[model samples]
Target chain A: MAQRTLLNQLIEALRCLPGVGPKSAQRIAFHLLERDREGGSRLARVMAEAMTRIGRCRRCRTLSEHELCGLCANPNRDPGLLCVVEQPSEIVAIEQATDYRGQYFVLGGRLSPLDGIGPEDLGLGLLEERLREGLVSEVILAISPTVEGSVTAQYIAECAAQGNVKVTRIAHGVPLGGELEYVDGGTLALAFTGRRAL
Target chain B: MAQRTLLNQLIEALRCLPGVGPKSAQRIAFHLLERDREGGSRLARVMAEAMTRIGRCRRCRTLSEHELCGLCANPNRDPGLLCVVEQPSEIVAIEQATDYRGQYFVLGGRLSPLDGIGPEDLGLGLLEERLREGLVSEVILAISPTVEGSVTAQYIAECAAQGNVKVTRIAHGVPLGGELEYVDGGTLALAFTGRRAL
Candidate 1:
């Protein structure tokens, strides 16, 4: 056990990350102190500020320092199309990989009823309210291809259908540059079924 | 480009860690904001406190909030046996793995000559002065087994010899619990050469 000092406290604090343990926490702490004290100081200051200021965007549920996030606040992004994702991390992945000029709606989580995550827990009512605005002509479901994700997509689709908006789930198949031999059986099956003429 | 905000600033700051890029930094920032805001705040507060207070222990060159580190100041540890390591991180690793009751001397870094790190750069003078004190009976070189590490170990051995102190480098062989089939060639050679008696 490390002595209860501020140094040890700093290391212990870093272990709250998903994969980081004591070794990595200590490494990161020492690295920050040795290499980038200014960055360490700024991280501390900004973390405190972000904790107090950042919250869910009122409209899309993405993290924001204000009522609305940058993606939701921009008028240039197409409001006629809305991409629904499980978390804010997926939004960043989509933005980097594709030229998606449409808006997004972060579900915050998926439908895992066994885990007590129901439609109500994921704010389906708010999603339906956004769909009823009539600005969105299409809603794209970009949830992961898990059982809970499928259920979430289905629920969101039904909600969107009520507003007469087309609901389309993102295609699941053999990924680009992925070898069929290495692709999972379920994905290969989907690719075979969704085959189209070149 | 992210908009300049406290959230963005925090994400940017987290990127200072080794192997952490923009994506991981953003993910860590969001993770903190959503699930562990309290932990994040604590990390921030601890980081600031540690940075402001923690400095090198004058005797051992390890991190300490005061003149001497806990290990150095403690009466229980053997002052006659000194463990020399390249970094503070290594000291933690050695302490956890072995019940070595010796005090430590952090070299901070090895002799990286290509990077222009000379003998003086590593504060070898301070180390020789410690050796000259005559209390140390043995100096254990726990530096890495790299080319530069070997050179640094050799140089320290010469310095310890001057004070009539026995200098020994930590053995390099297949790590404990590591399989022979999975082990690298250089390690296999070292293991064979340094084969222990049953």
Candidate 2:
């Protein structure tokens, strides 16, 4: 029998996503056909629209359909307390936690000199410009706890110090609601280092 | 931040395939945007086109872009030997093996009384009508080895017996290239029952 050419093409297109492989792509394509017609059309429309309309926010470099993203546009959010994150998904994770009530600056990616990713690649120049505006008082570096994340945090910390802004990295170690037995040795050490007295 | 409404919708819709979940759907939406614009458009075009154009073949009930599917239209194929299967994917798998030379009749689903699926639901009437045409000399039941597959096979066997047509079932149990030590007890038992002496 002849293959569904269009279906195969769509499946191939989906393989370019971060973690998707060919099999997953095929599954997704079939799922779209079997389940969500409206949803599939909406996805196509959104991709086309987002590609044309979404741009980097001028102030924070976060993805936005407008000149500024909602966080940057809001007046009530603390402009003095800015949380810096590496990717858009990280912003969503932090938002879900609902512990921070501050504006955000999305770096898009971290500095990885080995991979040729640098400060400019992550829009660090714009971050420095934002810090120089004199409205920000505290900067929270909420990047991943990887080695590259630590290096990026240090570089951003130095830049914040130069601008006379108080800079702090988010605490590392065991996750909330995690059992001690499940916590790894490296995380246990980090937890010990970040301990606070009652 | 305001949701990328259309993008989110598309992601949600694409999650309907058999094994797809939400995260994979999001990754797929992003992949389509970043790469494969041509392929993506082709998928969209084909989806819309297929929804408008493709239908079940009048003779065999297989998915067809035209009035008859490729298998049904080809004169070289044996019209006297008909292989019956449960789904389209099974046809693909059998085709990949390149051992089966006859055309197929897709039942769309099996007879599952517990699920309210019966002979009528599986289009047994059409099958009976096709058998009466006298063009079919033998009917091969190629359903899965599942309980439902067995029930469906029995039902079809009874239907073929009434027409005085020769009926046969594709072998069950141990797959080709399967090692006996690795085979499960249930499958091994079935293999022993269906065993052939070399």
Candidate 3:
């Protein structure tokens, strides 16, 4: 057996990236070695630091280098309005696309009993404690409309109700720029059922 | 102004990868942090070492940590048949898909005078010296059929002619398993002109 070179090792390691297959990994490796050595070096340094240093924010459970994420630490953000999401990336998506000025709670994933993801796994007990603290006026569900997501949202809504906090969900329907014909049946039905007087 | 977190910095740095835009960078960062920290750390360490240590092979100009690339150092490879390619990745492609056992020379790129690339820049002088040493009996051009590729191939063929060595090129045509209707015009024309006795 021929010894694998450093070039081969770099290519193999690059396969760890999501969506990068064998061909793409090889291409990325050669591209870095040939044209972007500086970029590759910087990526290595930053990636190493991020892998070791980043931990979940104690308050919101979002990825952060410190105890609290920047959003959780910000006094300007509304503590009275808590938005719940399934993943940290969803927080980024909401932040980029919307003007919502509220605090967030990351569930990490939807509740699935077969997968053993209980309320404790999602830190729901901590969320209930925050709700019981009495600062929160409203709890918003930005979770997906899947069965597991619905169960998770329902469970959280009940927890908020016990604390006498109002609960609402972000509207789900045909997206803003979507054509009605192209929208899926479930979304179109939701759009019709949720329609208000015009 | 809010301070950028290490997570954001990691996302930004990840964009340096070819074909990875903002969304993909964000996805990869989150994926590594959430699911594959071990793979991410290994990638970082290997990537750093490869970037800092790997250099061009003295003989073939292919990427290597040692002075000579593995293929160049291998005693089993035929020194009499020199196969020239435009990039180091092309060498890997040929090695995987073909059974031809011969020496390889990576030109790094074809002669693009508009981009200030010349013969010396491609290590063509070293190639010429090797041909003149009387050991190599055949020189094979596996370069692309672009205008610059043709010019480079023609120049190398002339160098071999001057040394009284046999020169050949890899055939270009509709690829194996390609449909005739989908094959492009230039390639179809080449296929017709290069048709062999069957």
Candidate 4:
């Protein structure tokens, strides 16, 4: 059957991408075949290498190919300030947007008991070990503002307290350049409460 | 630099896809790495195979791993009825939307001289050879109604005329579910001119 052709299989496989659907998958397959075989081949090579080689960093739990991620291995970055995030992708976001040179610890996800995720799954024991190391002076929580996120932040704060380390959370409020009238009520209220003295 | 990480390379390579950008590429790489590594590995294998192995069918110019495509190899399909389309992707669309169990010929693209595309570039000589064989009793043009498409259709019709084969074109008018008020003026005019007795 033409249904089992390699072209069809490629199209089907491309749907594994986050946003690609059946139609887009077909388009991508045909486009690669017709216009950009070189690019398609490059993507395949890089993707295969990444899938098989990349693993969680032992020190911080971010995706890496080595025992420790580049940030964790670099002595130039401050070891006294730790920024905690829910995912490795968020580490990339924070790096691109901010000048913070502190080391990072990835939770992978928040405390979602209904989904069977807990502190153990997030390697909280390792985080506690890092907290007890006495190197970190402050822990910054960059987790999203949700019920599970708050709970996760609270748990990490308690861990920091045990180690005599100060704990703080990134602020939550209406985004910069967002019109106050168009802002959602929850965000607007947060903005009001988070207002600065300036 | 962390910028040269394997994860980052995978994200950069993913941007080669048609619609993906920096943000979406990052999301796709992370999603595959974190959640669907199996699917990602499968995609890499299949995509590499397809890019290197899938070549155009000798009979119809559609993508195939063998000398002839599945439709060309199938004896049940009628060889006498030839449906011509501008792309291999359109062959899939027609196969899904209609039950026309006939052979197909891919033009690959319409005749756009300014873009260096011509009848010879579309393998029209091969199509003329098929027409001259007299095995095809009818030729159906399923190309779009663009200026270049019309020119291509006219050229193919002339080629069919030489072999005394019946030539027909799919009707161009208001789309099946289109509202009359919203139909474009050109399409409305075509609908009037191509009205059926029923």
Query: TM-score, each model?
Result: 0.85, 0.82, 0.96, 0.96
For B1-198, candidate 1 gives per-residue lDDT tens digits of: 256866778888888877799978988988898899998888878888887888988999988887888899889999999999988888888888899999999988889889999888788888999999999999999987878998999999999988899998788899989999999998999889878899
Cα lDDT computed for each candidate against the true fold: 0.87, 0.76, 0.94, 0.93
Per DockQ, what order, best first?
4, 3, 1, 2
Which regions of candidate 1 deviate over 4 angstroms? A192-198, B111-116, B144-162, B172-198
Which candidate leads the pack in DockQ?
A: 4
lDDT of 4 by residue, A1-198 (tens): 557889989989998988789999999999999999999999999999999999999999999988888999999999999999999999989999999999999999999999999899988999999999999999999998889998999999999998899999999998889998999998888788888898
Q: Candidate 2 clashing pairs?
A: A31-B17, A43-B10
Show the lowest summed lDDT stretch of 10 residues, model 3 chain A.
Answer: A1-10
Please provide, for model 4 over B63-177, each residue's C-alpha lDDT reduced to its tens digit, 9 standing for 90 to 100.
Answer: 8999999999999999899999999999999999998998999989999999999888999999999998889999999999889999999999999998999999998999989
How many clashing residue pairs are found in candidate 2? 2
Q: Which stretches of candidate 2 lie over 4 Å from their true place?
A: A17-22, A34-42, A176-198, B3-7, B22-53, B112-120, B145-148, B176-189, B192-198
Q: Give the TM-score (vs. native) of candidate 4.
A: 0.96
- Candidate 2 vs candidate 4: the DockQ winner is 4
Give the alpha carbon lDDT tens digit for every residue of A1-198 in model 2: 555444455666665555678767756655555456556665555555555665667878765666877778888888899999987656656887777889899887789999999999999998999899998999999998778988999999999999999998888978989899989988888899999889
Per-model chain B TM-scores are 0.92, 0.90, 0.97, 0.97
After superposition, candidate 3 runs with Cα above 4 Å error: A1-3, B1-3
Model 1 DockQ reads 0.56
Clashes of each: 0, 2, 0, 0
The alpha-carbon lDDT assigned to residue B109 of candidate 4 equals 95
